[model samples]
Target: MGTMAALVFALLAVNILLGSYTVTIPDFFAMLGGKTIPGASFIVMENKLPQALLGMLAGASFGVAGAVFQTMLRNPLASPDIIGISYGASATAVAAVVLFGVRGAGVSVAAIIGALLVALVITALARRRGGTGLILIGIGAAAFMQAVVTFLMSRADVSNAQELMVWLTGSLNSANWERVGLLTIALVVLAPFVAVGSRELRGLSLGGDTAAGLGFNVPRARLLLTILGVLLAALPTAAAGPIAFVAFLSGPIAKRLNGGAASLPLSGLVGAAIVLAAHFVAVNAIPGTSLPVGVVTGALGAPFLLWLLIYTNRANQGG
Candidate 1:
């Protein structure tokens, strides 16, 4: 965990201090001390710092949401992005932006609503169907919400289409202090609820019957975790449009690093590292072109998804 946190911090420093337009370590410190370095200060203050900060907070949010959902459900496939929660939130935000001109809190509320509604429906349908069924249903819901989002984009005006396309692709290009503040506020508010439910996540991971046997309120715990995960996932999606597979990949990566033991905090650090590193690569990988961070994470996630599926299959067969 300490190593992961250190990695995250190192990446955070690298992201802020070194970008396409590099800021010398001395200039970075000088800027922090209120000394202006022309051509460097504005870029760091307005462009790099906020982008890196928001990406960190948003990545942490995704990490916690994914870890909780996966642990609670005892399924690696049950990530928010995979199971429709991210898509639902994205669909709402896209609609709010394109169809209603909603911004700020309005888009957030819509996203939360969309995620919760989709989560509830999926949970209700898959109540008795086990984790595999839950994921199957979630995939279907994600497809449906994605279709809705596409329809909205298609019907939107050209300007809205352009904006929607950019947001959906998940770039930190438009990061600002206001967005950083909003995302920070979200994490602060959601932390207590998530903390209250955190202890229960491990107990729940042991299975419904085992959890109940151990005095854990299985149904209540599930609902609480579900709601907390939805909020965690939605808040970030509202700010960064889901950012692809950070959530899906973080928990498993953290668990593997921890010798197959789960750690939510470590998972969060890994998520932040993934985002910080991905953003850095996206901006610097090709000169004069800044690809969306989602594209990079998607590239990283696709192969992992395949490997995970194959591993799961082989494990089941061997068992």
Candidate 2:
């Protein structure tokens, strides 16, 4: 945990201190302290810093969402990105843009509402069919939502399609103080529920009957966590399009780091680190070609997904 937190801070510092337009440590401090350095100042304050901060906040949210989903379902593959939740947001946001011509925060609002609506449906299915069923159902829902997004994109006007494509790819290029402020409000609202969830998650990890035997309301706990996870994911997807795989990868990575246990807070830290590092690489990876952060995470996640599938299969066979 300590190591991961340090890495998050270090990546943040690098993003601020070393970028296209470099600023010395002192000059950066001076800018904060009521002085400006012309070209460097605008880039740092307006562009780079906002992206970096958004990366951390949005990443942490993704991490928590992933951790909650994975823990609640007891499946490594169960994440908002892999399930229908994120697609619900993306699909709604795209429809809002392409169909209704909504812009800015209106799109985000649509995304959040869409996510909750999808989650509510998925939860109903889970209640009837059980955990493994939940995963299968979620994957199917994801594919369905993806199809909706694709159809909308295909029919969208060129101008709207262009914007939609950029958002779908998930870039931090649009990061700004306004988004940062909204996400901070979201975090503040959700943090207490997350803290309260720690115990519920621990109980649920022991299995449903056991948790129930211990006086935990298993169904209620699951629903609460699911709602919490959805909001965590939806807000980030709204702020920055679905940055692929951070939500999918953060939990397993944190679990590994935690010696096969899960920690929501730790997952959040790992998530922040992943986004920060990925943003750096996205900007610097190909020099003149700055790819979207999602592209990088998507590339990284494909192999990890393959490995996890194989590993999980082997373990089940060995068992």
Candidate 3:
């Protein structure tokens, strides 16, 4: 825990110091302490800081939500991105930006609605069949959503296409203090609900029959946790577009770090670290490119996904 905390803080500090243009550590500290150094304040405050903070929030939310979903579903592939939640959010957000010229809060609301609708469909489908069926259905739904998003992009004007392109890649460049505040409030409120429900979540992991036998209201608990997970995931997706794989990666990383401990708190911290580190690298290391942090994550996560699939197949064969 101490090591993880130190790493997280170190990454945060590094992210602050590095951006599109480099800044010396002393100058970065001075600007943070309110000393104006032409371009320093704008770079730190307006650009790098908000991007770092939003990256942390976005990563942490996805990590926690992904952990919840994976635990509840008992499947490693159960992530917001894989299960259609992120796609749903992104599709609606892109539509709002391209079709309606809406931005900010309006986009957030649309994303939330889209995520909820997708989740509802997933839940309804899952309930009708079974757990495995739900995973298959989710995959199909996600493919359909991606096709729709591609079609929408094709129909957009060049400028709109450019904007949607950046957005679709999941950049945090447009974040401001307003987005930071919204995400912070959402995290503060939603995190406690997850913590409070931890015991039930643990019980749910043991299977519905076992949880019910142990005096838990299995269905209600499942519903509550699902809602909590959706809100955690949806808020960040709205705030920062659909980041590629923080949710998908964090839980497994945490589990490995903790030697297979239940990966809630640790996953959240890992999520923050991954996002902050990626953002730091994207901003500082990449120079004038203005690369999306999500691109960095996607580059890393795609391989991890391949490995996971291989591991799952091998494990099934062994069983």
Candidate 4:
């Protein structure tokens, strides 16, 4: 916990201080104190600070959402990104941008609606059966949504398609103070349920019947956690298009770090670190061109995911 906490803070500091337009320590403090320092102030106050803040918020939200979903379903592949929620948001946002010429908060709103609608569909369909059914359906839905996004992109004008593609890649280039506050408010509002749901998640982790034996209403607990998980993923997708695999990867990494014990707070911290570090690399590591943070994370996460699949397969075979 301590290590992850320090890592999150360090990454935040690095993200805010080491952008293209640097913020000296003294100048950062000065800017914080309501004193403008010419070029430094706008870069710090208007750009880097908000970018880092949104990244931290969105990362934490994705981490918690992933952790809860994985624990509930006992499946490594059961992330919002994998199970269609992220795809729903991505598809709707793309359509809004390309077809309807929507921008700004309108895109966010469309993404949120799409995510929530997908969540409703998943829950309604899965309620009649087991979790495996939900997972299969979600994967199918995700593929369908991805195709929708692709078709929309193909139909767009060349310039608009290029611009939409950047947003689709999940860049923080548009991060602003308003988005920071919006994400912050969302986290604050949704936090209590997550805190309560974390406890419920522990019960759910022990299996549905076992959780029921322990006096938790199994279905209710599952629904609450599912709703919370959806919101966590959706709001962030709205703020910054669905970040690649942070949601899928953070929980398992946190559990491994904690010796197979899941800690929501630790997972959230780890997530913040992942996003901030990815953003740093995205901006700095590429010479002559900056890539989206999602591009970097996707490159890193795909290999880890492949290894995890192989490991899980071998373990299941051994069992």
Ranking by TM-score: 1, 2, 4, 3
Candidate 1 stretches with Cα past 4 Å from truth are none
Decoy 2 TM-score against native: 0.97
Which scores higher on lDDT, 2 or 4?
A: 2
lDDT of 1: 0.90
Please say which candidate is ahead in TM-score: 2 or 3. Answer: 2
Clashing pairs in 2: none
Candidate 4 accuracy as TM-score:
0.94
Q: Which lDDT value does model 4 have at 139? A: 85
Candidate 4 local lDDT, 1-319, one digit each (tens): 9989998999999999986667789888988999988788887888788889999998998888888888899987888998999999888888888889997778878888888888788868887767778888898889999999999999999999887788778778779988888889879999899889989999999999999999999989988988888888888888887889998989999999999987788888877888989999998886766788899879978998798789988998995
Q: What is the C-alpha RMSD of each candidate to the true structure, in Å?
A: 1.3, 1.3, 1.8, 1.7
| Worst 10 contiguous positions by lDDT, candidate 2 | 15-24
- The true-versus-predicted C-alpha distance at residue 223 of model 1, in Å, is 1.0
Whole-model lDDT values for every prediction: 0.90, 0.90, 0.84, 0.87
lDDT rank, highest first?
A: 2, 1, 4, 3
Over 99-213, each residue of candidate 3 has an lDDT whose tens digit, in order, gives 8988878888888888888889999988967667777888888898899889889888899898778777778988899999989987898867888667777898888899999
lDDT of 1 by residue, 27-124 (tens): 88899899988888899988999989988988888998999999998999899999999999999888888878998779889999999999999999
Off-target runs (Cα >4 Å) in candidate 4 are 127-129
Compare candidates 1 and 2 on lDDT and give the better one: 2
On lDDT, the candidate that comes out on top is 2
